[model samples]
Target: MIISVDHGNKSIKTPHLLFTSGLVESENQPGIKTDCIFWDGKYYSLTEKRISYLRDKTEDDRFFVLTLFAIAKELEYAGIKEPDDTVDVTLLIGLPPAHYGQLHARFEQYFLRKREVVDFEYNGRYYSIRIGKVVSYTQALAAAVTRFGELKKHASSYIIDIGGYTVDVLKLRYGKPDLAVVESFEQGVITLYNSIFSQCNSQYALHLEDCDIDEVIKGEPTILPGEVQILIRKMASQFLTEFCNFLGERSIDLKVSKCVFAGGGSLLLRQIIERSDKVGFPIFIEDIHANAVGYDLLYKSEVAAHGGQ
Candidate 1:
């Protein structure tokens, strides 16, 4: 079995592909809220009722710990088992690129040291085993796979992934990522939300909890002020412009084929790209779970290449 785990700022998404004998079965574990409680190097998830209690407590760092615990519990619930009887299981997790170099060792230690387990029944067999070992890779790996697959039909392409907290831009030359042309920006949908809330306090007083910005943007202007909408559009435009300029300086031809967009923030930012005339080629948006799905596919391919049982 190959599992691709994406731990996002807002939620954790895990998608798995089980390769048994000559067959492949795929399943997605629902996203879990990013809330947990940390105790003695172990984390536990808080129940919905516990969240309500924490809202009223306001204790120092209590919310942070509880949030971590909540996430850990959810991972346990997602069929991760303890290694009661030693079995070979390889797990690969995706991490933010920036953290790859800095937190690699620490992350490995945490996963290996942590005794958490995921419990589930498979093919009439019950198993309880700790993740044998957890491996971590940059989100770029997943992003690269997604871009390559989406642009494989084209000769060359550029990928722009506007995620929750960052925007990753890369150029693919013949289905392979040209790292020299890849760039990332901290400004994303969250930045837009903060900007809107900062500018129009009364008109756009809603918080992330009260509204789903992605859903609201899909329909007509219902909650956000027109002024805020304008700002968001401008921000999106600027991001794309910067990305294009970076590509141009690197001598990457935007006219090669098309530009592909993915990530949670892409839905809202697609309009800005579609309306822009300064861009040279057409823009396309991949599915919201593109990264997760791509990673799952990549993991499966890797196992097959190794001739795993």
Candidate 2:
């Protein structure tokens, strides 16, 4: 089976499942073993506390372990329960457009293991699977793959992926990326989170997490003080303004180009982004799993072109 994964700094996503990028490892299984996976004598569980940004995700096995979790979740979603046979899994993954050139090859090699088959346990069920080909694609543009027919009508379009740790911008002229203009900026939603946390701590003497601020932005009823919620909305708007300025400094005039927004941050700040005058009316890819879904689509096209490679 071909399974695609979009490993974001804030979350890990598959076509059927999405979870935090956070991982908790333990030598022994915990008493409350919800969402636990056991592999190589170690226990791993998903957590909301995401890891710090890493320039190279292949530097450690953390991401690899997370990939295993993703695969297990995909299998579970497909109703492939504790089968006796070993399943071959061809994983389709992706990296930001800016990182594609330098890291794509390494990222593919990182998932290849010496052993032909591996066994792991998830939620008390065993899974035996072999890792086949690991394919990597560019991130920002991947989410826009399915809409190329529509995008081709435009002379120029921009895919602005507002992710957890980086805002990846890809300029596509006539539905294909202009490689020279593919860029990733460190100013992502995480920066806004940090800024909000700092300001809230100093002003209101209350520290806040992303979830707290998210509630405020979504206009969801919560226990937070109204003043704090107001501050969050205010800062979120300012963040969008600063983001527009950052893009402007790079000569990216969103006003002149058709823009498509993707990733979790874009969805969270949908209203705020729509309210910004810096951009023309933009199309937001509300599905957080768009990248993963795109990866699957791209992989299928590749396979068909190559005659079922």
Candidate 3:
């Protein structure tokens, strides 16, 4: 079985596939809530009804690690069974490039030390089990592989992952990430929303709620002052500018056979790139589960490489 967990700023997604008997099953999205709670040396996932409890408990505290726990809880909640005993499982997760240095080390320590299959209690019920080793969250690289498989011929490509909270631009030279050209930026949809909200409140007597912002992105054509649109354009422009600058600093040409966009925020940002005449080549956005599918490919490759059963 290969599982890929996509922990985004807005939601948590787990897509998994079981590989056995010489057949590959299509990945299924296991419906899972994104909230979790850690209490008394045991982790408990928060049901939709219990989400109110966490607000009072974890004010201003980091709950990023709970993202992984949320994935485990979801798997069990969906009744996805694992093999008996300790089965070798490879977990593929995605991490923000900037936090790779600090967060990666902490994740490794937390998962490797504790191998217990403790109950992920949620709403007074045991929801899931946390198993397997803490594997690398290399979904960005996996996304490249996923996109490459769809291309008819091999060519260099640039993958701009405009995720919920961050944007990662990576160069795929001959279908693999050129580590030297990879860069992460903090400007993402969440930050964009904050900027729009700030500008709206300052200029007009308007306070934008979360759903209102989403509604705008969903093609509602928000009735904002023209200045707000300019601010948004500027923010997006700066992000792409920094990405281009990073490529320039690395002496990497902007030439690519195709520029692929993957992530939840891609739909909103698609027009931003479409309007830019300087951005060469056709831009393509992969399906929402592109990373999950790519992670499945990587998981199978790793298992084959290691000679797993």
Model 2's C-alpha root-mean-square deviation from the true structure amounts to 1.2
lDDT of 1 by residue, 149-245 (tens): 5567666676767765666666677767766656666755666555555545555664443133453455455556666656555645676676567
Ranking by TM-score: 2, 3, 1
- Encode model 2's per-residue lDDT on 233-273: one tens digit a residue: 99999999888888889898887778999899999999988
**Candidate 2 positional error at 99, Å:** 0.8
Better of 1 and 2 by TM-score: 2
lDDT of 2: 0.89
* Residue-level error in angstroms, candidate 3, position 31: 22
In candidate 1, stretches whose alpha carbon ends up further than 4 angstroms from where it belongs are 16-90, 97-99, 114-129, 144-150, 153-155, 202-216, 225-257, 283-285
Candidate 2 positional error at 126, Å? 0.8
Best by lDDT: 2
How big is the positional error of residue 253 in model 2, measured in Å on the Cα after superposition?
0.9
lDDT of 1 at 125: 37
Task: Report clash pairs, candidate 2.
Answer: none
Off by over 4 Å in 3: 16-69, 72-90, 97-102, 221-257
Clashes of 2: 0
Q: Model 1 residue 224 lDDT?
A: 62
The digit string of per-residue lDDT tens for model 3 on 1-309 reads 345666565545555421110111113322454334443454434332111112111242223334435454545656744424333334566666556655665655445436565443333344344446666555466666766755425456777777656777777767777776676766566676676678678877688765565554444677765665565567666655665566567664454336777776776666666666536764565466666667667777877999974
